[model samples]
Target: MKYDWILFDADETLFHFDALKGMQLMFERKGVNFTEQDFHQYQQVNKPLWVDYQNGNITAEELKHIRFIGWAEKLGTTTAELNTAFLEAMADICTLLPGAKELMDALNGKAKLGIITNGFTELQAIRLERTGMTHYFDQVVISEEVGVAKPDAGIFLHAMERMGNPSKERVLMVGDNPHSDILGGLNFGIETCWLNVHQHERPEGINAHYEVQSLHELRSILLA
Candidate 1:
């Protein structure tokens, strides 16, 4: 293996995070018909909160609370209740991305695998368990628990410490987001691979050591 450890970002990188479908399932469970317009409205609040959370302007708890404020009001419930419900729905619908399992299987014995996610702890555990991917990882780090979101070096440092402080050059951080995953890993002095599954433009000044559109490509590179 080229690297001793392969760190991954959860959500879009390994798991298919279909927020719209998750929200729809959540509302359905609550006896509400969630429409596309409703999801659009929800994103208007949710997206910026995530940005703020990643930027350290807001906390994970605050982001969770604020994003569901409108929905909570409509549902006559507390933000905590709605947030929990949404996470539950998301967990129920969670599945690994195509080729994700194969990639993990191929690398299981060859490299140490771990997950460092900005995703909430509640959904993270259940999703891993449900998808049967829990045992494949050596470590699972959540920003909510660590008190630092990605794009900040602190979280990467925390992950490294937990990883037994391996040589940074022998670690590869694989994730979908350039700003958070790639930049964060690069800034932390580790090699990075940007998993641009949707073909998004790479942001300026945040180059990755490798870029691939699919986990299959990553597997080929790693097992080459």
Candidate 2:
């Protein structure tokens, strides 16, 4: 492997985080059928909250609560209760992305691995354990615990500190988001790989050092 340490984003990079499905499952437990229209409306409130969370303009708690406020009112439940149920539903459905296990297996002995996620603390650990991915990572940094999200250098610095201060040149940050994962690694002076599964156009100035469509492509590049 070219890099000594690999830091990954948890959601779409390693796991399939289907928020709509997870929300539907959550509401199903509450005896409500969450439709696509409901999910669309939820995203209208949730997406911008995620952006605000990443920009450090809001706390994770705030985002969690505010995004579910409408649903909570409709369901006659507290936002916190809805939020916990949503996370639980997400955990129940968690699975590794295609080739995720194979790539990790290929890289396990060759390089050290870690996860730096903007995802909530409640889901990260359980997903790792449930997916049997716990042993593959040496560090798991959640922005909620750090009080900062990705695209910010602070969270990256915190990750590096826990990693015994590995050389920036010898580290690679991989994720699916161009703004957070790519830009954040670039700002922190580390190599970056963007996992653009949807073939989205690269944003204006956020250039990743490498780009691949899937973990298999990444493994080919790294394990060659």
Model 2: residues with Cα > 4 Å off, grouped in runs: none
What shift in Å separates residue 207 of candidate 1 from its native position after superposition?
A: 0.9
What stretches of model 1 exceed 4 Å from their correct place? none
Q: What is the lDDT of every predicted structure here? A: 0.93, 0.95
Decoy 2 TM-score against native: 0.99
In candidate 2, the residue pairs with backbone N, CA or C atoms under 3 Å apart (3 or more residues apart, or in different chains) clash, namely: none
Q: Which candidate is the best by lDDT?
A: 2
Q: What are the TM-scores, per candidate, against the unseen true structure?
A: 0.98, 0.99
RMSD of each: 0.7, 0.7
Model 1 global lDDT (CA atoms, 0 to 1): 0.93
The stretch of ten residues in a row with the least summed lDDT in candidate 2 is 68-77
